[model samples]
Target: MTVRSTAPKDTLGEELVRFDGVVKRFRTSLGRRQTALDGFSMTIPRGSVVGLLGPNGSGKTTALKALLGLVRADAGTIRAFGRQLPEGQALVASRMGALIEGPAFTASLSGERNLRLLGELHGVGAETVAEALELVGLTQAARRPYSGYSLGMKQRLGVAGALLAAPELLVLDEPMNGLDPEAVRDMRALFTRLRDERGMTIVVSSHILAEVELVCDRVTIVRHGTVIRDGPVGELLDRGTVHTVVRVEDVTAARSVLERAGLAVTAAVGPQGPELHVGATAADPGPALLKVLAEHGLYPQELRLRQASLEDVYINAIREADAARGATGAAGDVG
Candidate 1:
């Protein structure tokens, strides 16, 4: 479906949302205080898909809640559309929509009816509701009772509700939680269409790093309630280590040669036969690797370069963050 919006284009690609040094804490049942967010900060560019990614208990959801004004921050500042939050939430309420955790619906009500009810509350028109349903690929199943809808179908309906108001900024937490492969593909396309066709900015928080890598223009990874990595997907990926896969007959010999040459090597079986993966510490270790392999009479049948995946970068970032935290804690104990 062609989704078009005539909303003001003056601020397209500009900073639409900003979270600065935000801090949030909660009191657990045991009377211990938990830091949900500590100096968390991020910015969402207008008309772009930004991925808010982190492991469990990484303050992703808490940051979203604080932005929506569902919870207040003890410190730091948030601004949406250049208006300070909490004070200006009402003014920008009509421009933002969010689906946090999972959405709830009346069991007996049909999906169409549920969305219609939401439209009524938001002063949205019936045609808009229909458009939303079609945009989310739920038109055929729109009449299905909410109780009978599959998990993926329910997620689609929740997304349709978020789109009902034609919001400018959409925040979705774990939107792909229960979607099947096909549904995930459709949702990714929907996000692209929303950004390209409708010119809407999106903030998606999910643990699916691969999906985030495919759909997000920029990624912000948080740990211990603070951002440890934040940049455009391309820039971040390029900053990671380069990998070269060498297909050779003598895999064991090739591994020895590469490792002795100061390269990290691993073995794996590929489509043809055994292959050696060389993690190049230096940039462009291709020529040097080939020379060394030829020197040892272990010529490569085929050699190819591979870029680091988002998952690889994410793992390294988390490990580094954890190691830093561990060292800090040790120093504190020493003190």
Candidate 2:
């Protein structure tokens, strides 16, 4: 593992990384001003996994790039290791590793050889390389040529390289891209092990909400370069915010009844059959839904209350952002 830099340590309870009111702007080819990051702010705590989530172009990459000094923010404050960014970037980066987009590996080199070549540049020794390989469980195949390795194996090697520094913080953007289901599951477990065993703080950027929910301690959803939602998975979808799915004999009639009652209704497919998602209200929404459907001469073949998934929370956040944008755009035209 690489030696930790002597950068000033963070005070207790202070986040490992913090961005406050960060802004970044770009100009389109046609000379129009395009804001990629606008008032974007987020924090990553020590010994935690934080996911940067949003649809494509929601500024997830821009945020990460700004933190790593790959891109400069036009305004706002950023910190790493309790010190300001860019200035602290050199020292702090010495104690962190990242796999942004796709890692670059020499196709001609073996997995272990590639890591060794890169590690040598960073002063990482053979022992550390072996340990990193073991950590990522790439020891047996380490000698295999990089070109022959499967996508998952290549990814594991990338992680092994990132582990070279035994970094206190690991920043990965869409690390799970192009992996099969099994590989995805394996990678998720690997990231968890890194945090629980190494006390490493991780900041991952991804649009895959379901996996993010499973892997991240907290999630931040961004839209139009602004944070739309940020919280632990359960907190965003609290017990009070559960959804009820109702599959009725008449989909149209049941949907109309639910919507007419002032509750949000969305057509969905439940585990058992076609269903409608009804937002929960009060103590128990299941009973109330049944009562309403009965009043409308509609009965559901199946009715159940389900906890909201991370995808549900993400979708709601984006939808709300879209509505807000629409309203603001309309208001701008009116006056």
Q: Which stretches of candidate 1 lie over 4 Å from their true place?
A: 1-10, 247-257, 266-276, 281-284, 290-302, 330-335
Q: Residue 156 of candidate 1: its Cα lDDT?
A: 88
Error of 1 at 51 (Å): 0.7
**Ten contiguous residues minimizing lDDT sum, candidate 1:** 326-335
Name every residue pair that clashes in candidate 2. none
Where is model 2 poorest over a 10-residue stretch in terms of lDDT? Answer: 4-13
- Candidate with maximal lDDT: 1
lDDT per residue as tens, model 2, 115-229? 9998887788899998888876678998888999887787778877888877888988888876778778877888898777667788888766778889899889898898989
Residue 191 alpha-carbon offset, candidate 1, angstroms: 1.3
All candidates: TM-score: 0.88, 0.89
